[model samples]
Structure formats: structure tokens, C-alpha cells
Target: MLNLSESINKTLNNFAENTEMMWNFADDATDVLLGDLDTEIASTPYEIVYQQDRVKLKYYKSEAPVKMKTPLLVVYALINRETMLDLQPGRSVVKTFLDNGIDLYMIDWGYPTRKDRYMTIDDHVNGYMDDVVNYILKREKVPQVNLMGICMGGTFCVMYSALHADKVKNLVTTVAPTNFDTDQGLLHSWMKSVDVDRMMDTLGNMPGDLMNFGFLLLNPARLMIDKYQSFLENMNSRDFVENFVRMEKWIFDSPDVPGETFREFIKDFYQGNKLINSQMELGGKRVDLKNLTMPLLNIYGKFDHLVPPGACELLTSRVGSTDVQDVCIDTGHIGIYVSSKCQREFAPKICSWLGERDGNFSEPEVSSPVKKKTSKAKPAALQN
Candidate 1:
């Protein structure tokens, strides 16, 4: 019996050693395969429609152009490029909206340069955003425009709508953070504790790479390790490999945020929790949530690590809009916009929601010539 036990132990040790060796070999092979896939994926053709500053606005054109009942403007976060909306032909939010007869205009907050170091939230929300909105109003000859804000862009859109209620008909916010007090979001907690002044002083412009690294750290086991393993197992499949590569390109293609904007964002929004509290101010004007009276649709993700349901739900209570609805989709932060599952459920839901509200949509009437006021009302700050 002793001899039999010894033999079994030896066999088990040999098996364990062999398994380790196979794992090492597989890891090496996966590295090489992924490297190749990355190169191929980065080369995929993406058609971006408009360019403002360093920002690129990519859209998937509809096969048949249908005149949308409402002209919609989409504002994406400045942290990353806006390609996530139009990731691919079939899996595109913009395409889905366009196909559903929504005329879309997305803001590309372009790459911030050294000169843009002092660019504040006001600049984005008031300056550039105002210009874009006015341009759309003029081009379409519309009185009021529908505004859609995603993530941080949603926060900006909310502010913009509040300050310029006359310019906006309806507002839609997807995965936008309004309450930073929620503990469910790891990113918000980190931002709350961060010394924005020191960080900005240390780095004139907040490095995009650093922000990307933080996002990766949020789900290291999944994003950094498990994803690679899955890629290797499915490397032989061309479609899978191609899709993987495209996602990787979109993931790594991050843009640097301006320093002043970063400083105010951390202090005012994340740390102070000002937006919901109505303590936030932009360009010397207080950002009162009560000022937002237009119809509002707040879309949130149930499992979003970045902007949890709690963070987004706060908007419904804070905003003065009587006609407000909250939609909670079962998806993660990025998955809400890009994943195949969300593409079917999330995108279509937005289209339907907007369509239902189309009755409220009205074009801005041409103003009759009048004596100009001594001073025009100051535009809201441009920061999204």
C-alpha cells in the first residue's frame, strides 16, 4: 500500500509539472498572436465625418436618409475619443439612431494641446459647444435642438441645457455621473481623494496614458489577463480576432485632458458633489439644477463600474424637469454603448424613447428684428 501511494504521488507531481509547461507555452503563443491581431485591427477602416480642432467625429451613414423629426446633438466625454458610438457598421449607436430617423450631431472635444492647458469646463460647455449648437440650428433651420450627453458629456449637457433652456427641446443623458457621493463607483472615489492641483501642476496636461492605465486597473483581472486568454483560445477565428483588434484600437486610443478642466472637474464635480447640490458654478454663473426645466431622459447602466446607477439616478430628483424618466439597462460602462448585447437593447430603446417624445419637438422660430440689448446674456461655459 505504501509503494502504491508513492507511485501515485510521483504521477501527480509529473502531471502538475507538465500542466505548468503547457501554460507557459500557451502564454507565449498568445502574446505573439495578440501582437499580430493588434497590428491588423489598428488598420481597420473607420470613416469619421467631421473634424473640430483635434477631435474627430465618426458616424455611420444611414443607407436611406430619412428627415428626422428632431435634430439631435450628441456630446461624448472628453476623456476618450467618440469612436465607441460608431465602433463598427453593425454595432453602431449612431447608425441605429440615424436609421431610426434621428439627425445626429456629435461633439469631438479634440485633442488638447499645450496651448489648451488653461481650457476650462466653461470653454467646452459655453464656447465650443455653443458654437456647435448654433451651427446646427442655423444649418437645419431648427428652433430647438435635442441634446444627448454620454458619460461626462452628459454632465456637460445637463449644465448646458440648464443655462440655455431656450436652445434645447429635450435632453438625454446616458451613463452620466451627477452624484459623486456613491461608493459603488471606484473611479469616483479615487477622483474624490485626488489632489487635482498637485496633479495638474506636476503634469501640465493630464496625460491620457495615465487615465487609461487607471481604467485598466479597475478590472485588471478581466481587461489585462482574462481578455488575453480568451483572445488566444479564439485566435483561429478570423471574425473574432478582427473584432478583438478593433476593440483594442478603440480602447488604447485615448486623448489627454486639459489641466484647468481636470482641476475643476475633480474639485467641483467629484469632490464637492456640486452639480446635484447646486453649488457648481461655471464662468461666474451658478449651475442650478432647478434651471433645467426641459424634458429629460436619464439613462443609466445597472452594472456600470464608472458611473453606477446611484450616481446617475440622483439627476432625476435634482433636476427641475417635471417630465423626467430614468432607464436602467443591465450593462457595464463601455458595454452600454459598444457591446453586441447593448447594441440590440440599449440603442433601440433610445430610438423608441426619442420617437415617442417627437410630438414635443418643435423648430426654433425665427426671431423678428429687434433693438439689440445693451449687453447680450453671457453664454454658458463650454466644458463637456
Candidate 2:
């Protein structure tokens, strides 16, 4: 009877301790939640050099000397805004590039309206992208510019390089899906069966909210549940809350993809797998992978579910480039750019790779006036 009483006393004490801890956590969380937080993203300063309809070219000037003779044009996917690259000062790919003396240009495929529903892959590739490249080439007075693309943007860069090989000095693709026939990812499986024509006919442009819902469905347990649960647990930390909110802004700030672009991307690339089979066409010309003769750097996340390694790894063999390198980083799709470890690997690799290939040329003078846009509150272990 004495031992039983002691056991009960111990149990009650433990429960009381846990309850006190919970109360402390709640108070701290409330304090942090009520505090002023700086959640603004894409805070890197840039100038808008060229604008065509919804697409704009952003030029990020480096205070350091330009190391590479060839300027880099970064093309991000249409689904997400390019603000993702400049997510935060510490984890920013843009800041890393600028710090490394890379003269950078990025394409901003702005929000698509109902009128943009008629825009197709051909229009984006041959029309807007080509025009952007030409403007860069002329503005910089360089014969060729380095091209890098992310996700769908990488696929676009591949097509652009193949179609206009002479204008591209080197090509870099990050987590870009080229061969989509494999069922390694749920996206590929769903896309294959998706009736894109019907979707486009009914919705005009592919809705951003719908796309976000689909991506959330991809890994609901982690992306939807686990992430928020983590937030609640760490809500007392101001830095944690700030970073969490920044990512939340980027993840949900998805823009609607153009209708015809979405339709063709689904039917041709995902369904028929025409790109890998050499059956893809744009602007009345075949996109011959053999024309990708320039130096190629293909970087993809090993654990990327949306664009699996199987989808990206096949490109090196198919491309005509003799000096090709494939780097498989141990990370997920978005993690490749934002993860802390990758901050060390990702931009440095590009700098060294480009520096080696960057031939001798005097620095070019900036002829165009710096056009500043108002600051809008927006917004990696290598295993090869």
C-alpha cells in the first residue's frame, strides 16, 4: 500500500511537469506570433532591362568584377515565380552568383491572364525566350550567353539550346524533366492520364490554386502535415517563424500556366514522351538533341519526386556535347536550391565550371541605363 501511494505520487508529478512545459510553450509561441516579423522574399536588388508583355528580363549586377565573359540567363518554370531563387539573403542562389562575380540575367514569366491562354510552347520557346536571348546577346555584346533553367524552365533551355546552339555558350539544367515516360514519380503517372485538352478548354489557363493543391497531394504527410506541425513546435523562435513564412509565401504564390503551353507540355512531353523520342517540334523545326554541342552541366536532385533522376539522367547520353557532367545532389526538388549545404556546392560548381570554359575577353561596358523597379514585398550534397 505504501509503494502504490508513492507510484501514484510520481505519476502525478510527471503529469504536472508536462502540463507546465506545455503552458510555457504556449506562452512563448504567443509572444513570437504577436511580434513583428520580416517575411519579405526576393529581397535581392535587380533592374528590369527588357519587358515584353508578361515576360521581363532581370539583370543582377555584381559589385565585384565580372568573372565570366559570357553572361548567364536563368529561366525559371512558369508555375512558380522566379522569386524562389532569391528566397532569402543567406540561402539565395542569386546572391551567391552575384558574390561569385557572375553577370546574371533572369526571365520573369509574369502572371498569365485569360488572354495568355492561346500562348503555346512554340510561342514561349521561339517567341519570348528567343527574343530574350537576342536582347541579352545584343546588350552584352557577347556572341553567346550561358543558359540555365530550372524545372520546366530547364526543359525550355534545352529546347532553346538545341534550336539555337550557336547563341548558347554552355547549358545548365537543374531538376528539369526531359524524359517523362517512367512511372518513378506520381506527377508523371498523373500527367500521362490527364486530359489536358479538356482541362484547357474548361479552365482557359491552368489555375495556380489547382496546381498547388496537386503538389500538396504529392506528399501530404510531409508538405501538408509535417511542415505545419514542425512550425507549431518551433513557433517560439523568431528566425524559424520568419523562414517558414517566407517559404509559405513562395510555395503558395504560384502563377497560372498558359493554357496551350500546359496542354502541349502535358500531351507531348508527359503523355507521348516525344521530347526524348525526338518527335518534339517547335516553330516548324525539330529539336535535335545533337545540336546541344556546347558544354553541358546537368544537375538534378536524387530524391526529386516530381522530376526523378531517371527523367534527368538520360539527357547526358542523348546530348551531342562531349564535355558533359552529371551531378546528382542528395536533396528534393526545391531543397536543391534552398538547402544550406547546397549553398556551398551549387553556385561554386557553376562558377568554377564556367571559369574554366570562359575564354579570354575584355569586360564589356554597360550601354543600357539601369532601370530600377520598385521593391515589391514578394515572395545540397553532390553525389556524382
**Which numbered prediction scores highest in TM-score against the true structure?**
2
lDDT of every predicted structure (CA atoms):
0.77, 0.86
* TM-score per model over all chains: 0.81, 0.91
Output the worst ten-in-a-row residue range by lDDT, candidate 1.
365-374
Query: Any residue pairs clashing in model 2, and if so which?
Result: none
The Cα error of candidate 2 at residue 203, in Å, is 0.4
Which digits, one per residue and each the tens of the lDDT, describe model 2 over residues 90-142?
77888877766788999999999999999999899899999999999899998
Candidate 2: residue 138 lDDT (0-100): 94
What is the per-residue lDDT of model 1 for residues 8-115, given as tens digits with 9 covering 90 to 100? 999899899899876776776576566654333212233555566765544333343445566888999988877788766656777666666676777778778877
Root-mean-square deviation of each candidate, in angstroms? 11.1, 6.7
Give me candidate 1's TM-score against the actual structure: 0.81
